[model samples]
Target: MSRDIDYGNLMHSAMRGLIKTVLQDVADHGLPGAHHFFITFDTSHPDAELADWLADRYPGEMTVVMQHWFDNLVVGEDGFSVTLNFGDAPEPLYIPYDAIKTFVDPSVEFGLRFESAEDEDEEEPSADPMPPAINTDHAQEDADTAQKSDAQVVSLDSFRK
Candidate 1:
Protein backbone atom coordinates (compact mmCIF):
# COMPACT_ATOMS: atom_id res chain seq x y z
CA MET A 1 0.00 0.00 0.00
CA SER A 2 1.23 3.49 -0.85
CA ARG A 3 0.35 6.74 0.84
CA ASP A 4 0.39 10.20 -0.57
CA ILE A 5 2.76 12.91 0.53
CA ASP A 6 0.38 15.79 0.16
CA TYR A 7 2.40 18.95 -0.19
CA GLY A 8 -0.65 20.88 0.94
CA ASN A 9 -0.71 18.93 4.17
CA LEU A 10 2.97 19.49 4.66
CA MET A 11 2.74 23.21 4.08
CA HIS A 12 -0.36 23.49 6.24
CA SER A 13 1.31 21.77 9.18
CA ALA A 14 4.49 23.78 8.78
CA MET A 15 2.60 27.08 8.70
CA ARG A 16 0.54 26.10 11.69
CA GLY A 17 3.70 25.28 13.60
CA LEU A 18 5.09 28.75 12.96
CA ILE A 19 1.85 30.42 14.01
CA LYS A 20 1.68 28.27 17.11
CA THR A 21 5.14 29.37 18.14
CA VAL A 22 4.34 33.02 17.78
CA LEU A 23 1.07 32.65 19.62
CA GLN A 24 2.72 30.74 22.43
CA ASP A 25 5.39 33.39 22.85
CA VAL A 26 2.81 36.11 23.16
CA ALA A 27 0.74 34.06 25.56
CA ASP A 28 3.66 33.31 27.87
CA HIS A 29 6.01 36.31 27.68
CA GLY A 30 3.78 39.07 26.34
CA LEU A 31 5.14 39.82 22.88
CA PRO A 32 8.91 39.63 23.19
CA GLY A 33 11.51 40.64 20.60
CA ALA A 34 10.85 42.68 17.45
CA HIS A 35 8.16 40.32 16.28
CA HIS A 36 4.58 41.38 15.97
CA PHE A 37 2.30 40.26 13.15
CA PHE A 38 0.13 42.01 10.62
CA ILE A 39 -2.00 39.01 9.75
CA THR A 40 -4.10 39.21 6.58
CA PHE A 41 -6.41 36.32 5.93
CA ASP A 42 -9.40 35.19 3.94
CA THR A 43 -12.38 36.31 5.96
CA SER A 44 -14.70 34.01 4.07
CA HIS A 45 -12.68 30.89 4.64
CA PRO A 46 -15.01 28.08 5.76
CA ASP A 47 -13.52 28.02 9.24
CA ALA A 48 -13.53 31.77 9.56
CA GLU A 49 -16.47 33.69 11.00
CA LEU A 50 -17.13 37.37 10.80
CA ALA A 51 -20.33 39.21 11.54
CA ASP A 52 -22.17 40.07 8.35
CA TRP A 53 -21.06 43.60 9.01
CA LEU A 54 -17.37 42.86 9.01
CA ALA A 55 -17.59 40.18 6.35
CA ASP A 56 -19.15 42.61 3.93
CA ARG A 57 -16.43 45.07 4.79
CA TYR A 58 -13.64 42.62 4.14
CA PRO A 59 -14.83 40.20 1.50
CA GLY A 60 -11.41 39.14 0.33
CA GLU A 61 -8.55 39.63 2.78
CA MET A 62 -8.00 42.02 5.64
CA THR A 63 -4.88 42.90 7.55
CA VAL A 64 -4.92 43.30 11.30
CA VAL A 65 -2.18 44.88 13.34
CA MET A 66 -1.36 42.77 16.37
CA GLN A 67 1.06 45.20 17.97
CA HIS A 68 -0.94 47.97 19.63
CA TRP A 69 -4.42 47.67 18.21
CA PHE A 70 -5.67 44.27 19.31
CA ASP A 71 -7.11 43.09 22.61
CA ASN A 72 -7.94 39.79 24.29
CA LEU A 73 -6.11 37.60 21.80
CA VAL A 74 -6.65 33.91 22.50
CA VAL A 75 -4.84 31.00 20.92
CA GLY A 76 -6.62 27.69 20.78
CA GLU A 77 -5.78 24.22 19.57
CA ASP A 78 -7.24 24.44 16.06
CA GLY A 79 -7.50 28.16 15.67
CA PHE A 80 -6.86 31.57 17.28
CA SER A 81 -9.19 34.43 18.14
CA VAL A 82 -8.56 38.12 18.50
CA THR A 83 -10.62 41.25 19.09
CA LEU A 84 -9.97 44.46 17.21
CA ASN A 85 -11.46 47.91 17.42
CA PHE A 86 -12.85 49.20 14.18
CA GLY A 87 -14.33 52.55 15.00
CA ASP A 88 -16.29 53.02 18.17
CA ALA A 89 -17.07 49.32 18.27
CA PRO A 90 -14.96 46.22 18.78
CA GLU A 91 -15.22 43.20 16.53
CA PRO A 92 -14.12 39.70 17.41
CA LEU A 93 -12.86 37.28 14.76
CA TYR A 94 -11.85 33.64 14.98
CA ILE A 95 -9.56 32.35 12.27
CA PRO A 96 -9.16 28.61 11.93
CA TYR A 97 -5.99 26.69 10.97
CA ASP A 98 -6.89 26.80 7.30
CA ALA A 99 -7.97 30.39 6.92
CA ILE A 100 -4.69 32.17 7.33
CA LYS A 101 -3.18 33.34 4.04
CA THR A 102 -0.28 35.53 5.06
CA PHE A 103 1.24 36.94 8.21
CA VAL A 104 3.40 39.97 7.57
CA ASP A 105 5.37 42.51 9.58
CA PRO A 106 6.42 45.68 7.85
CA SER A 107 8.85 46.54 10.63
CA VAL A 108 11.05 43.46 10.57
CA GLU A 109 10.08 42.62 7.00
CA PHE A 110 9.39 38.97 7.73
CA GLY A 111 6.36 36.97 6.62
CA LEU A 112 4.76 33.57 7.20
CA ARG A 113 2.13 32.41 4.76
CA PHE A 114 -0.45 29.67 5.26
CA GLU A 115 -2.24 28.01 2.36
CA SER A 116 -5.63 26.41 2.78
CA ALA A 117 -5.81 22.75 1.90
CA GLU A 118 -8.74 23.35 -0.39
CA ASP A 119 -6.82 25.87 -2.42
CA GLU A 120 -3.87 23.54 -2.70
CA ASP A 121 -5.95 20.66 -3.91
CA GLU A 122 -7.56 22.87 -6.52
CA GLU A 123 -4.32 23.29 -8.43
CA GLU A 124 -4.05 21.49 -11.77
CA PRO A 125 -1.52 18.73 -11.38
CA SER A 126 1.48 19.02 -13.61
CA ALA A 127 3.43 16.06 -14.98
CA ASP A 128 5.51 16.10 -11.79
CA PRO A 129 2.57 14.72 -9.75
CA MET A 130 3.49 16.94 -6.78
CA PRO A 131 3.07 20.70 -7.03
CA PRO A 132 4.53 23.13 -4.56
CA ALA A 133 2.74 26.44 -4.09
CA ILE A 134 5.28 28.06 -1.86
CA ASN A 135 8.36 28.88 -3.88
CA THR A 136 11.22 30.87 -2.36
CA ASP A 137 13.27 31.28 -5.55
CA HIS A 138 11.03 33.96 -7.03
CA ALA A 139 11.96 37.54 -6.17
CA GLN A 140 8.45 38.55 -5.11
CA GLU A 141 8.09 35.37 -3.14
CA ASP A 142 10.96 36.09 -0.72
CA ALA A 143 11.35 39.83 -0.93
CA ASP A 144 10.51 40.54 2.67
CA THR A 145 12.74 37.85 4.12
CA ALA A 146 15.67 38.67 1.85
CA GLN A 147 15.30 42.39 2.42
CA LYS A 148 15.35 42.02 6.19
CA SER A 149 18.29 39.64 6.23
CA ASP A 150 20.24 41.98 4.00
CA ALA A 151 19.45 44.95 6.21
CA GLN A 152 20.45 43.08 9.36
CA VAL A 153 23.76 41.95 7.84
CA VAL A 154 24.55 45.47 6.71
CA SER A 155 23.91 46.83 10.20
CA LEU A 156 25.95 44.05 11.80
CA ASP A 157 29.00 44.85 9.66
CA SER A 158 29.44 48.21 11.41
CA PHE A 159 29.70 46.53 14.83
CA ARG A 160 32.24 44.03 13.52
CA LYS A 161 34.47 46.75 12.08
Candidate 2:
Protein backbone atom coordinates (compact mmCIF):
# COMPACT_ATOMS: atom_id res chain seq x y z
CA MET A 1 0.00 0.00 0.00
CA SER A 2 1.22 3.53 -0.79
CA ARG A 3 0.08 7.01 0.11
CA ASP A 4 1.10 10.38 -1.30
CA ILE A 5 1.05 13.91 -0.02
CA ASP A 6 0.43 17.13 -1.95
CA TYR A 7 3.42 18.85 -0.38
CA GLY A 8 3.58 21.87 -2.67
CA ASN A 9 0.06 23.08 -1.96
CA LEU A 10 0.40 22.01 1.66
CA MET A 11 3.47 24.18 2.25
CA HIS A 12 1.91 27.10 0.38
CA SER A 13 -1.10 26.92 2.65
CA ALA A 14 1.05 26.91 5.82
CA MET A 15 3.28 29.77 4.67
CA ARG A 16 0.22 31.96 4.16
CA GLY A 17 -0.12 32.38 7.92
CA LEU A 18 3.44 33.61 8.30
CA ILE A 19 3.21 35.97 5.33
CA LYS A 20 -0.09 37.33 6.61
CA THR A 21 1.29 38.28 10.04
CA VAL A 22 4.41 39.97 8.72
CA LEU A 23 2.75 41.83 5.84
CA GLN A 24 -0.30 42.84 7.82
CA ASP A 25 1.71 45.03 10.20
CA VAL A 26 3.71 46.58 7.38
CA ALA A 27 0.56 47.24 5.38
CA ASP A 28 -1.67 48.64 8.11
CA HIS A 29 0.58 50.57 10.50
CA GLY A 30 3.80 50.88 8.49
CA LEU A 31 5.65 48.43 10.84
CA PRO A 32 4.31 46.96 14.01
CA GLY A 33 5.40 48.26 17.42
CA ALA A 34 9.06 47.54 18.10
CA HIS A 35 9.04 44.40 16.00
CA HIS A 36 11.16 44.37 12.85
CA PHE A 37 12.43 41.69 10.49
CA PHE A 38 15.89 40.20 10.18
CA ILE A 39 15.80 38.58 6.79
CA THR A 40 18.80 36.55 5.61
CA PHE A 41 19.26 35.60 1.98
CA ASP A 42 21.52 34.77 -0.95
CA THR A 43 23.14 37.88 -2.36
CA SER A 44 24.09 36.19 -5.63
CA HIS A 45 20.61 35.35 -6.78
CA PRO A 46 19.72 36.55 -10.30
CA ASP A 47 17.36 39.18 -8.91
CA ALA A 48 19.67 40.11 -6.03
CA GLU A 49 22.21 42.94 -5.80
CA LEU A 50 23.93 44.64 -2.93
CA ALA A 51 26.88 47.03 -2.97
CA ASP A 52 29.76 45.17 -4.63
CA TRP A 53 31.84 45.88 -1.57
CA LEU A 54 29.27 44.38 0.77
CA ALA A 55 28.77 41.37 -1.45
CA ASP A 56 32.47 40.65 -1.17
CA ARG A 57 32.43 41.40 2.54
CA TYR A 58 29.58 38.98 3.25
CA PRO A 59 29.75 36.34 0.57
CA GLY A 60 27.44 33.64 1.85
CA GLU A 61 24.52 34.80 4.01
CA MET A 62 23.92 38.26 5.37
CA THR A 63 21.06 39.35 7.58
CA VAL A 64 19.37 42.73 7.22
CA VAL A 65 17.11 44.42 9.68
CA MET A 66 13.96 46.12 8.39
CA GLN A 67 13.19 49.04 10.65
CA HIS A 68 11.92 52.60 10.44
CA TRP A 69 15.31 54.16 9.64
CA PHE A 70 15.40 52.50 6.21
CA ASP A 71 14.98 54.61 3.07
CA ASN A 72 13.30 53.80 -0.26
CA LEU A 73 11.39 51.04 1.48
CA VAL A 74 9.19 49.33 -1.09
CA VAL A 75 7.78 45.80 -1.17
CA GLY A 76 7.20 44.79 -4.77
CA GLU A 77 5.48 41.78 -6.30
CA ASP A 78 8.86 40.37 -7.27
CA GLY A 79 11.20 41.72 -4.56
CA PHE A 80 12.11 44.55 -2.18
CA SER A 81 14.86 47.14 -1.68
CA VAL A 82 15.88 49.74 0.88
CA THR A 83 18.85 51.61 2.22
CA LEU A 84 20.13 49.96 5.39
CA ASN A 85 22.85 51.21 7.68
CA PHE A 86 25.72 48.76 7.76
CA GLY A 87 27.66 49.99 10.71
CA ASP A 88 28.25 53.65 9.71
CA ALA A 89 27.80 52.95 5.99
CA PRO A 90 24.30 53.07 4.51
CA GLU A 91 23.98 50.64 1.61
CA PRO A 92 21.04 50.01 -0.67
CA LEU A 93 20.18 46.39 -1.53
CA TYR A 94 17.67 44.44 -3.58
CA ILE A 95 16.54 40.95 -2.60
CA PRO A 96 14.25 38.67 -4.56
CA TYR A 97 11.47 36.92 -2.68
CA ASP A 98 12.98 33.63 -3.81
CA ALA A 99 16.34 34.39 -2.19
CA ILE A 100 14.94 34.79 1.29
CA LYS A 101 16.04 32.00 3.66
CA THR A 102 14.93 32.88 7.13
CA PHE A 103 12.97 35.66 8.77
CA VAL A 104 13.32 36.00 12.52
CA ASP A 105 11.95 38.53 14.97
CA PRO A 106 13.22 38.29 18.55
CA SER A 107 10.84 41.01 19.67
CA VAL A 108 7.93 38.66 19.18
CA GLU A 109 7.59 35.04 20.27
CA PHE A 110 7.21 33.84 16.69
CA GLY A 111 9.41 33.27 13.64
CA LEU A 112 8.88 33.01 9.86
CA ARG A 113 11.22 30.70 8.02
CA PHE A 114 11.85 29.65 4.42
CA GLU A 115 14.34 27.60 2.43
CA SER A 116 17.21 28.93 0.32
CA ALA A 117 17.96 28.06 -3.30
CA GLU A 118 21.17 26.31 -2.24
CA ASP A 119 19.21 24.00 0.02
CA GLU A 120 18.05 22.04 -3.00
CA ASP A 121 21.49 21.99 -4.62
CA GLU A 122 23.30 20.14 -1.88
CA GLU A 123 23.02 18.41 1.47
CA GLU A 124 23.40 20.57 4.58
CA PRO A 125 26.34 20.06 6.90
CA SER A 126 25.77 17.76 9.82
CA ALA A 127 25.83 19.11 13.38
CA ASP A 128 25.58 18.13 17.04
CA PRO A 129 22.10 17.08 18.12
CA MET A 130 19.92 17.63 21.21
CA PRO A 131 16.41 17.55 22.74
CA PRO A 132 13.37 19.91 22.65
CA ALA A 133 12.08 23.05 24.36
CA ILE A 134 8.96 25.16 24.72
CA ASN A 135 10.11 27.86 22.32
CA THR A 136 12.37 26.70 19.53
CA ASP A 137 13.88 30.16 19.19
CA HIS A 138 15.55 30.13 22.59
CA ALA A 139 19.36 29.99 22.67
CA GLN A 140 22.23 29.92 25.10
CA GLU A 141 24.78 32.71 25.60
CA ASP A 142 28.17 32.95 27.26
CA ALA A 143 27.47 34.76 30.46
CA ASP A 144 30.75 36.64 30.23
CA THR A 145 30.79 37.50 26.53
CA ALA A 146 27.73 37.44 24.24
CA GLN A 147 25.54 40.52 24.20
CA LYS A 148 22.04 40.28 25.60
CA SER A 149 20.42 42.03 22.65
CA ASP A 150 21.48 39.52 20.01
CA ALA A 151 18.84 37.60 18.07
CA GLN A 152 18.22 34.12 19.37
CA VAL A 153 19.65 31.18 17.40
CA VAL A 154 18.27 28.01 18.85
CA SER A 155 19.94 24.77 17.86
CA LEU A 156 17.96 22.86 15.22
CA ASP A 157 17.77 20.06 17.77
CA SER A 158 16.30 22.40 20.32
CA PHE A 159 13.00 21.83 18.59
CA ARG A 160 13.13 18.23 19.77
CA LYS A 161 14.68 18.97 23.19
Candidate 3:
Protein backbone atom coordinates (compact mmCIF):
# COMPACT_ATOMS: atom_id res chain seq x y z
CA MET A 1 0.00 0.00 0.00
CA SER A 2 1.80 3.10 -1.27
CA ARG A 3 0.25 6.30 0.06
CA ASP A 4 3.03 8.43 -1.40
CA ILE A 5 1.05 9.86 -4.26
CA ASP A 6 1.84 13.27 -5.82
CA TYR A 7 -0.97 15.13 -4.02
CA GLY A 8 0.62 18.51 -4.61
CA ASN A 9 0.55 18.00 -8.39
CA LEU A 10 -2.98 16.67 -8.22
CA MET A 11 -4.08 19.65 -6.11
CA HIS A 12 -2.41 22.02 -8.57
CA SER A 13 -4.22 20.41 -11.47
CA ALA A 14 -7.53 20.59 -9.57
CA MET A 15 -7.02 24.27 -8.75
CA ARG A 16 -6.22 24.98 -12.40
CA GLY A 17 -9.44 23.18 -13.32
CA LEU A 18 -11.24 25.54 -10.96
CA ILE A 19 -9.73 28.50 -12.73
CA LYS A 20 -10.78 27.12 -16.10
CA THR A 21 -14.28 26.47 -14.81
CA VAL A 22 -14.59 29.98 -13.41
CA LEU A 23 -13.27 31.56 -16.62
CA GLN A 24 -15.64 29.45 -18.72
CA ASP A 25 -18.53 30.62 -16.59
CA VAL A 26 -17.40 34.22 -17.06
CA ALA A 27 -17.29 33.68 -20.80
CA ASP A 28 -20.77 32.18 -20.83
CA HIS A 29 -22.57 34.27 -18.19
CA GLY A 30 -20.15 37.12 -17.44
CA LEU A 31 -18.75 37.83 -13.97
CA PRO A 32 -21.59 37.01 -11.61
CA GLY A 33 -22.71 39.86 -9.35
CA ALA A 34 -19.74 41.73 -7.81
CA HIS A 35 -17.32 38.82 -8.28
CA HIS A 36 -14.13 40.00 -9.93
CA PHE A 37 -10.73 38.36 -10.24
CA PHE A 38 -7.18 39.37 -9.49
CA ILE A 39 -4.92 37.13 -11.57
CA THR A 40 -1.16 37.21 -10.95
CA PHE A 41 1.16 35.45 -13.40
CA ASP A 42 4.71 35.44 -14.71
CA THR A 43 5.22 37.81 -17.64
CA SER A 44 8.55 36.22 -18.61
CA HIS A 45 7.01 32.75 -18.99
CA PRO A 46 7.29 31.52 -22.59
CA ASP A 47 3.58 30.66 -22.91
CA ALA A 48 2.45 34.10 -21.77
CA GLU A 49 1.83 36.78 -24.43
CA LEU A 50 1.56 40.40 -23.51
CA ALA A 51 1.79 43.62 -25.47
CA ASP A 52 5.28 45.10 -25.84
CA TRP A 53 4.44 47.98 -23.50
CA LEU A 54 3.03 45.62 -20.90
CA ALA A 55 6.03 43.26 -21.13
CA ASP A 56 8.37 46.26 -20.79
CA ARG A 57 6.52 47.57 -17.73
CA TYR A 58 6.07 44.13 -16.11
CA PRO A 59 9.27 42.30 -16.95
CA GLY A 60 8.97 39.88 -14.04
CA GLU A 61 5.51 39.05 -12.68
CA MET A 62 2.30 41.10 -12.95
CA THR A 63 -1.16 41.11 -11.44
CA VAL A 64 -4.22 42.19 -13.42
CA VAL A 65 -7.70 42.87 -12.04
CA MET A 66 -10.60 41.92 -14.23
CA GLN A 67 -13.63 43.90 -13.18
CA HIS A 68 -15.22 46.80 -15.02
CA TRP A 69 -14.01 46.98 -18.61
CA PHE A 70 -12.82 43.82 -20.36
CA ASP A 71 -13.96 41.96 -23.47
CA ASN A 72 -13.36 38.89 -25.59
CA LEU A 73 -12.72 36.72 -22.55
CA VAL A 74 -11.93 33.32 -24.00
CA VAL A 75 -11.10 30.39 -21.70
CA GLY A 76 -9.35 27.46 -23.26
CA GLU A 77 -8.39 24.10 -21.72
CA ASP A 78 -4.80 25.11 -21.00
CA GLY A 79 -4.92 28.92 -21.11
CA PHE A 80 -7.02 32.04 -21.46
CA SER A 81 -7.05 35.31 -23.45
CA VAL A 82 -8.87 38.52 -22.79
CA THR A 83 -8.92 42.04 -24.20
CA LEU A 84 -8.57 44.55 -21.41
CA ASN A 85 -8.41 48.35 -21.56
CA PHE A 86 -5.26 50.16 -20.59
CA GLY A 87 -5.16 53.96 -20.91
CA ASP A 88 -8.33 53.76 -23.01
CA ALA A 89 -6.70 51.34 -25.46
CA PRO A 90 -7.68 47.69 -25.68
CA GLU A 91 -4.81 45.22 -25.35
CA PRO A 92 -4.96 41.47 -25.46
CA LEU A 93 -3.31 39.39 -22.75
CA TYR A 94 -2.63 35.69 -23.03
CA ILE A 95 -1.91 33.79 -19.82
CA PRO A 96 -1.14 30.09 -19.51
CA TYR A 97 -2.31 28.06 -16.49
CA ASP A 98 1.25 27.05 -15.64
CA ALA A 99 2.36 30.70 -15.46
CA ILE A 100 -0.32 31.76 -13.01
CA LYS A 101 0.89 32.53 -9.47
CA THR A 102 -2.28 33.58 -7.70
CA PHE A 103 -6.00 33.97 -8.21
CA VAL A 104 -8.14 36.03 -5.87
CA ASP A 105 -11.65 37.33 -5.53
CA PRO A 106 -11.47 39.90 -2.75
CA SER A 107 -15.21 40.38 -2.74
CA VAL A 108 -15.57 36.83 -1.48
CA GLU A 109 -12.30 36.86 0.47
CA PHE A 110 -11.12 33.85 -1.56
CA GLY A 111 -7.63 33.33 -2.90
CA LEU A 112 -5.32 30.59 -4.20
CA ARG A 113 -1.58 30.61 -4.81
CA PHE A 114 0.10 28.40 -7.39
CA GLU A 115 3.70 27.28 -7.70
CA SER A 116 5.07 28.12 -11.15
CA ALA A 117 6.22 24.98 -12.97
CA GLU A 118 8.59 27.06 -15.13
CA ASP A 119 10.35 28.37 -12.04
CA GLU A 120 10.63 24.91 -10.51
CA ASP A 121 12.03 23.50 -13.77
CA GLU A 122 14.60 26.30 -13.98
CA GLU A 123 16.02 25.59 -10.53
CA GLU A 124 19.40 23.83 -10.77
CA PRO A 125 19.77 20.72 -8.67
CA SER A 126 22.76 20.31 -6.36
CA ALA A 127 25.64 18.25 -7.80
CA ASP A 128 26.11 16.20 -4.60
CA PRO A 129 23.30 14.79 -2.47
CA MET A 130 25.12 15.59 0.77
CA PRO A 131 26.26 19.20 1.31
CA PRO A 132 30.01 19.84 1.87
CA ALA A 133 31.05 19.83 5.54
CA ILE A 134 31.38 23.34 7.05
CA ASN A 135 34.81 24.44 8.37
CA THR A 136 33.86 26.19 11.67
CA ASP A 137 37.38 27.64 12.21
CA HIS A 138 37.35 29.53 8.86
CA ALA A 139 33.70 30.59 9.39
CA GLN A 140 34.52 32.00 12.88
CA GLU A 141 37.56 33.86 11.48
CA ASP A 142 35.41 35.32 8.70
CA ALA A 143 32.83 36.45 11.26
CA ASP A 144 35.58 38.11 13.34
CA THR A 145 36.89 39.92 10.23
CA ALA A 146 33.36 41.12 9.39
CA GLN A 147 32.99 42.49 12.97
CA LYS A 148 36.30 44.38 12.60
CA SER A 149 35.17 45.95 9.28
CA ASP A 150 33.77 49.53 8.81
CA ALA A 151 30.12 48.34 9.12
CA GLN A 152 28.13 50.40 11.68
CA VAL A 153 25.26 49.09 13.83
CA VAL A 154 22.69 51.64 14.97
CA SER A 155 20.64 50.35 17.91
CA LEU A 156 17.06 51.49 18.58
CA ASP A 157 18.15 52.16 22.20
CA SER A 158 20.33 55.03 20.91
CA PHE A 159 17.21 56.79 19.56
CA ARG A 160 15.49 56.29 22.95
CA LYS A 161 18.57 57.69 24.73
Candidate 4:
Protein backbone atom coordinates (compact mmCIF):
# COMPACT_ATOMS: atom_id res chain seq x y z
CA MET A 1 0.00 0.00 0.00
CA SER A 2 1.30 3.48 -0.82
CA ARG A 3 1.35 5.98 2.03
CA ASP A 4 1.77 8.96 -0.24
CA ILE A 5 -1.43 10.91 -0.91
CA ASP A 6 -1.48 12.44 -4.38
CA TYR A 7 -3.66 15.44 -3.56
CA GLY A 8 -2.80 17.30 -6.71
CA ASN A 9 -3.85 14.43 -8.96
CA LEU A 10 -6.96 13.92 -6.86
CA MET A 11 -7.93 17.55 -7.22
CA HIS A 12 -7.35 17.39 -10.94
CA SER A 13 -9.67 14.39 -11.23
CA ALA A 14 -12.40 16.14 -9.25
CA MET A 15 -12.14 19.28 -11.33
CA ARG A 16 -12.31 17.30 -14.55
CA GLY A 17 -15.35 15.46 -13.27
CA LEU A 18 -17.01 18.79 -12.58
CA ILE A 19 -16.34 19.93 -16.10
CA LYS A 20 -17.70 16.70 -17.53
CA THR A 21 -20.91 17.01 -15.52
CA VAL A 22 -21.46 20.61 -16.58
CA LEU A 23 -20.77 19.82 -20.21
CA GLN A 24 -23.08 16.79 -20.11
CA ASP A 25 -25.84 18.99 -18.76
CA VAL A 26 -25.26 21.46 -21.54
CA ALA A 27 -25.35 18.68 -24.09
CA ASP A 28 -28.63 17.33 -22.73
CA HIS A 29 -30.48 20.61 -22.25
CA GLY A 30 -28.57 23.31 -24.01
CA LEU A 31 -26.65 26.05 -22.16
CA PRO A 32 -29.02 27.55 -19.66
CA GLY A 33 -29.48 31.29 -19.29
CA ALA A 34 -26.26 33.31 -19.34
CA HIS A 35 -23.89 30.41 -18.78
CA HIS A 36 -21.07 30.01 -21.25
CA PHE A 37 -17.67 28.34 -21.22
CA PHE A 38 -14.18 29.28 -22.24
CA ILE A 39 -12.26 26.00 -22.44
CA THR A 40 -8.53 26.12 -23.11
CA PHE A 41 -6.87 22.83 -23.93
CA ASP A 42 -3.49 21.58 -25.06
CA THR A 43 -3.81 20.86 -28.75
CA SER A 44 -0.69 18.68 -28.72
CA HIS A 45 -2.23 15.93 -26.59
CA PRO A 46 -2.14 12.58 -28.38
CA ASP A 47 -5.84 11.96 -27.82
CA ALA A 48 -6.91 15.42 -28.93
CA GLU A 49 -8.25 15.50 -32.48
CA LEU A 50 -8.70 18.53 -34.69
CA ALA A 51 -8.29 19.63 -38.25
CA ASP A 52 -4.80 19.84 -39.71
CA TRP A 53 -5.27 23.57 -40.23
CA LEU A 54 -6.32 24.03 -36.61
CA ALA A 55 -3.37 21.98 -35.40
CA ASP A 56 -1.07 24.17 -37.48
CA ARG A 57 -2.73 27.30 -36.17
CA TYR A 58 -2.65 26.35 -32.49
CA PRO A 59 0.40 24.22 -32.17
CA GLY A 60 0.51 24.42 -28.41
CA GLU A 61 -2.94 25.27 -27.08
CA MET A 62 -6.34 26.57 -28.12
CA THR A 63 -9.27 28.18 -26.41
CA VAL A 64 -12.85 27.66 -27.59
CA VAL A 65 -15.91 29.61 -26.56
CA MET A 66 -19.16 27.69 -26.02
CA GLN A 67 -21.74 30.41 -26.27
CA HIS A 68 -23.80 31.61 -29.20
CA TRP A 69 -23.41 28.59 -31.49
CA PHE A 70 -22.05 25.07 -31.07
CA ASP A 71 -23.18 21.69 -32.39
CA ASN A 72 -22.78 17.95 -31.81
CA LEU A 73 -21.51 18.14 -28.24
CA VAL A 74 -20.86 14.58 -27.13
CA VAL A 75 -19.42 14.05 -23.68
CA GLY A 76 -17.74 10.73 -23.03
CA GLU A 77 -15.87 9.16 -20.10
CA ASP A 78 -12.45 10.24 -21.31
CA GLY A 79 -13.30 13.38 -23.23
CA PHE A 80 -15.80 15.34 -25.27
CA SER A 81 -16.30 16.24 -28.93
CA VAL A 82 -18.00 19.29 -30.36
CA THR A 83 -18.45 21.21 -33.53
CA LEU A 84 -17.71 24.91 -33.38
CA ASN A 85 -17.95 27.60 -36.01
CA PHE A 86 -14.67 29.19 -36.94
CA GLY A 87 -15.49 32.20 -39.09
CA ASP A 88 -18.00 30.60 -41.47
CA ALA A 89 -16.63 27.09 -41.27
CA PRO A 90 -17.76 24.44 -38.81
CA GLU A 91 -14.82 22.58 -37.31
CA PRO A 92 -15.08 19.43 -35.25
CA LEU A 93 -12.74 18.89 -32.33
CA TYR A 94 -12.13 16.22 -29.70
CA ILE A 95 -10.52 17.36 -26.48
CA PRO A 96 -9.52 14.87 -23.81
CA TYR A 97 -10.12 15.80 -20.19
CA ASP A 98 -6.46 15.54 -19.32
CA ALA A 99 -5.61 17.97 -22.11
CA ILE A 100 -7.69 20.76 -20.67
CA LYS A 101 -5.64 23.60 -19.21
CA THR A 102 -8.39 25.88 -18.02
CA PHE A 103 -12.17 26.06 -17.84
CA VAL A 104 -13.89 29.33 -17.14
CA ASP A 105 -17.48 30.48 -16.98
CA PRO A 106 -17.05 34.24 -16.86
CA SER A 107 -20.78 34.82 -16.82
CA VAL A 108 -21.06 33.24 -13.36
CA GLU A 109 -17.61 34.10 -12.09
CA PHE A 110 -16.32 30.51 -11.95
CA GLY A 111 -13.09 29.05 -13.23
CA LEU A 112 -10.66 26.16 -12.87
CA ARG A 113 -7.01 25.85 -13.88
CA PHE A 114 -5.07 22.61 -14.10
CA GLU A 115 -1.30 22.27 -13.94
CA SER A 116 0.06 19.44 -16.01
CA ALA A 117 2.05 16.69 -14.32
CA GLU A 118 5.07 17.77 -16.35
CA ASP A 119 4.71 21.29 -15.00
CA GLU A 120 4.53 19.97 -11.45
CA ASP A 121 7.63 17.86 -11.99
CA GLU A 122 9.56 20.86 -13.32
CA GLU A 123 8.85 23.00 -10.24
CA GLU A 124 11.79 23.64 -7.91
CA PRO A 125 11.60 22.24 -4.39
CA SER A 126 12.04 25.76 -2.98
CA ALA A 127 9.22 27.16 -5.09
CA ASP A 128 5.89 27.91 -3.48
CA PRO A 129 3.58 24.89 -3.57
CA MET A 130 0.48 27.02 -3.47
CA PRO A 131 -1.13 27.60 -6.85
CA PRO A 132 -1.76 31.17 -7.87
CA ALA A 133 -5.13 32.69 -7.03
CA ILE A 134 -7.81 32.49 -9.74
CA ASN A 135 -9.87 35.58 -10.28
CA THR A 136 -13.31 34.37 -11.36
CA ASP A 137 -14.50 37.82 -12.27
CA HIS A 138 -13.77 38.87 -15.84
CA ALA A 139 -15.29 42.32 -15.62
CA GLN A 140 -13.35 45.08 -17.33
CA GLU A 141 -12.96 47.14 -14.19
CA ASP A 142 -9.98 48.39 -12.16
CA ALA A 143 -7.88 45.48 -10.93
CA ASP A 144 -7.38 46.99 -7.52
CA THR A 145 -11.06 47.65 -6.98
CA ALA A 146 -11.97 44.26 -8.32
CA GLN A 147 -9.60 42.57 -5.91
CA LYS A 148 -11.06 44.53 -3.02
CA SER A 149 -14.67 44.08 -4.05
CA ASP A 150 -16.91 41.01 -3.79
CA ALA A 151 -15.13 39.34 -6.67
CA GLN A 152 -14.56 35.65 -5.93
CA VAL A 153 -11.00 34.39 -5.90
CA VAL A 154 -10.63 30.65 -5.39
CA SER A 155 -7.44 29.04 -4.08
CA LEU A 156 -7.39 25.29 -3.56
CA ASP A 157 -4.00 25.43 -1.85
CA SER A 158 -5.77 25.89 1.46
CA PHE A 159 -7.22 22.41 1.07
CA ARG A 160 -3.81 20.91 0.33
CA LYS A 161 -1.25 19.77 2.85
Predicted candidate 4 versus true structure: per-residue lDDT over 9-128, tens digit per residue: 888899899999999999999999867676778889999999999899888887777776889999999999999877668889999999988776766777776766465576464253
Model 2, total clashes: 4
What TM-scores do the predictions have?
A: 0.65, 0.63, 0.70, 0.77
> On residues 70-155, what C-alpha lDDT tens digit does candidate 3 reach at each position?
89999997899998776667889999997877776655656676654443465684353111211113323343233223223222
Q: 1-161 in candidate 1: lDDT tens per residue?
A: 99876655566577677787788678667766655565667778888976788788778766555654566778888888877666546778898866776665545655665544444466573352111222222333354334333322111112221
lDDT of each: 0.59, 0.55, 0.68, 0.74
TM-score of 1: 0.65
Candidate 1: Cα lDDT at 91:
76
Runs in model 1 deviating more than 4 A are: 116-161
Give the Å shift of residue 60 in candidate 1: 2.6
lDDT of 2 at 152: 58
Model 3's alpha-carbon lDDT is 0.68
Number of the top candidate by lDDT? 4
Clashes of each: 0, 4, 0, 0
- True-vs-predicted CA distance for residue 131, candidate 4, Å: 18
